[model samples]
Target: MTYRVKDMPACKGCPFYQTGEQGFVPDEINTGAKLAIIAQNPGELEELDGRPLIGRSGQMVIASLGTYGIKREDASWLNVLKCRWQNENILPREENILRGAVDHCTGAYLRQNLARIRPNLYVPMGDLALHWLTGRENIGHWRGSVFIADSGPIRGSKVLPTIHPAAIFRQPAWRSASKSDFSRIARELPKREPVVTYSDVFHLGVSAEEFINTIAALKGPVVLDIETKSTRPKSERKPIEETLAVIGIGWGKDVAANYVCDAALDEVLRAIESADVDWIAGGAFDFTVLTHYGVKFKWERCHDLILLHSRFDIELPHSIEFIASMWTDRAYWKHLTDTDLLLYNALDCAAEWEAWYRLAAFCKARAPLVWKVYMEDRPLIEVQVALHLAGMPTERGRIQAEKRWYEKERETAEKALLAAFGSTQGSATAVPVCATHKRYTGKSPLKARKGEAEVCSTCAAVRRSYIDSQPLNLRSRPQMIRKLRESGIRVPLTREGKTSLAKGVVSKLLKKYNDPRLAQLLNYWSKSTAVSRYFKEAWISPATGRIHSVYSMHSAKHRWSCQKPNMQQTKRPEKVLESLGDIVETAE
Candidate 1:
């Protein structure tokens, strides 16, 4: 039967929103459905349209299910999280602050819903889902495994973990993860008959025959995992497959083309998973997502990244960002703490985990809390601790001695920013790219049209200009994207529309991230000397026409970040910030 969310009695006129004409409460399956997918939350479009998987990420999800036997219209999806992940797109602090409430509702729904659906295969789409499944909030240990925890609905069925579909949308390279995922579905897919036709251009880079051959050649039991987002808050779980990006790329990594915050990270991740010849964070999330993407593996003897370290009496990291940035540059979470190192080569991808484990070992010695958390019960706590440990010792005597090093880093960073200002003394803040000028002129060098992605020259040149204009002082990518979006212009898109990677113009325009530019003017349309160092395009801010850069005081701790100035955030800028004042090059 077709289902629209039934507005639960508690949600009627929730203080957070203005109630509109009431709709059905999100259905807690009383019966009839065989398989249920638990996820994070509904996107704005889904809430407004009264449809699941119809939102930007949902579209890709609904389409992906077609590849298997599932259909949003046919099979039921129960989100572990509910509500519009409001304003996070603009003001993340507000979103982060509001997350506490979101988490409450999610727990209530799952506590009640799991008792309802009781499907044989409890598919938690991402790490969040798995958090509740394994009864542990720590992602390091839970990322790639299936366990019978006395929590959630996994008690009643085989918990099959698959990559979130959002990953494929964000990182096409993650198609490798999807291949095996589909194969898993194909195995369990009811043989009655195919009821749906999923129209997806994405495919496994290698055929199933080749995959099987590769697995045989390797000749050993493989590690496997199922990454699922929790139904309790953390709305990223809404699209089940988006979680796979965590598996492919290091969890929390977003160094791909465009970053929609979810799927965009998934594509680059797929690249990492397929490239892992020896150890790529050595976990099951990778194997499981690969399973869905048409790749297959035997998981009789799987090992966990945390287990390996724990065996060595090591502490686990809070997030992949710590290991990646602190340890492995090619690792996904590297952006959480370090500068952009676009891991464009296969060798870099292979070395990622080496860096990650190396840092994990190093940081274990310097962990701030000096406590131990089991992967079984500490996913969230571990992430927190890892970030804390990954922080560098600030450049100060007393503070370093007192271990108040973060303050020293802040002071140093501030001084650097001031010095950069001095270097640019009176260089009429190169006007932020105006829409008309950008359209007619050229784009950035990072986005310079190459091969078939067929980016626009104007867009490419403008991207280059932004690269040239960045002041020498910035911290990470989060700061960059935040400032760019605040400055009032379109953020670039990865081919996947995930991060503002400035790739395929056709892809971003075709999917989400569609900005209605007024002949290229943002609504606020104010001007600024400096925008967030995150993008090659212009982002809009509150009607002030002024660019605002919001800083998360603790954006980096345990590791490096792909975030710009928040520079290491993800989808590295078209050009490095170090070269900002240089003149633009003519490419078009």
Candidate 2:
């Protein structure tokens, strides 16, 4: 029989199931049951039949219990919500749910069940169920530790407030960890008769935040830097007979050079190219120059310093002289000395590599792993890492969106350049001659190709002006013009841009051949960087079939750095087979 809150009715026609055996009415309870599981509410089936968590929730609990060395038959179960709130049976007012939680009689029923069962351990599955069982207002705060019941048969016992198995079902990754949580419950069962407190079992609980914090702190293994001749006046460029030094060095995962320098220079070159460790200096300019001189040294890894300065935090000096002084720790102002320029440049290049290493380490240790990139040139790993870490700490979905945005931005920049300069190379109608010569000697095109002398006038003026604008790139005009005439714009390559065009092939940046975006950007070198020379071919990676650029995070700002091979340029696409394979490449 059922009773009202204000009035009560005795059990009439209903036979006393266990009352006679226990020698008391509903309030009295048995004292043999050791475990009590209080799930939130009766789902459909249990609500209809008037039982506890015996449906989906009960089945899962039983399964979890089995894993913890406890069987379903070993425990008595109770429901926070005695009745199921089915689709139609749910009350129009939440007042009933609140009453179920707030009413003293409801709690008394719990007390009666525990008193009859005498369960030592009570497990509350969810928030509401916890409230129904323990009438404490702040049920969650009191969850982990054992709270003595103010009114219950098995008062002063320990409680294990764990996530409801239903929630675990929704997030399966939580299963393994949650099972560990359940195991703790069984561990406390031994001291049950003495009523172990909640603090005794619940210590520090684990969460998901710490896992990614560590992954975000990874940095690369190699450092790189470059050197350049940015000191001369813009108009002074002339491609003449001059020797370029080649320094064969292994970078990243160090590999020995294929062709060692001559014996006379071996000692010095080997000292520089030990291959003992990954060594990176700016663009393999020296490498290519050496290659031109019959030194075909195969290289696998290299980090471009310009990219490091641009992408990482490195101090940006207004002049190359100042940069040289600071990074090399040797004054570059005195170039007239017998000292060699390329060798001196190498010193600054090594400093730049270290700067990148330090900055990379700093980023790895303190930053986040996830990011959102709205814009990027190649892949600015440090910036990506920073943005990724910041976003990962907050929202993951936004980081992915940012990555796509950067990809689109890079693509857009490529399309825009191709739109402006088309694929074909431009040409001049005539050539310029030098002012000193009265007649066109074809020596200095900046003067004129033929004519009277304002110093002399037969120059292809507009083309000359365009070429002059590219002062950062020092190309001897007369020599370039002759080469252009022979090679055309699209040959295998011409020392001169005009020569490539003259040969009917457009010689764009070697980096651009494989990557359209890089080629388009290379076309904007005049606007992009302070340089007179362009890259030859890229230092390719065979590991993933995708190119990897080595960059330091502070070269421009002083905290990071990197370098390209040769001088003042990134690695270009390789023209030959296996020229730029992985440093530690394998057949598989």
Backbone atom clashes (below 3 Å) for every candidate: 142, 81
TM-score of each: 0.36, 0.30
lDDT of 1: 0.39
Model 1 misplaced stretches (Cα beyond 4 Å): 1-8, 12-25, 28-30, 87-110, 138-146, 153-156, 188-473, 476-588
- Residue-wise C-alpha lDDT for candidate 1, range 306-343, written one tens digit per residue: 43333333333323333332333221222221233222
lDDT of 1 at 214: 42
For residues 1-588, could you state the per-residue lDDT of candidate 2 as single tens digits? Answer: 322212222222112111211111122222465777776545555533445555676687778778877876677776543432211223224665456333543454555565566566777777666655654443323333344455433347666666677776565644543564466667666666424211111111112122112112323333322222333342331111123332322222211121212334433433333333343444333333333334323243333444433343223322333322222222222242236443333334343444445434543565322111101332343342232122112122332233233345445654575454442334433444435433433323342111223433433454454444342221233443433344432234455423333212333434334544334444543223322222221222232232222223434333433333122342222342243243213321
Count of backbone collisions within predicted model 1 = 142
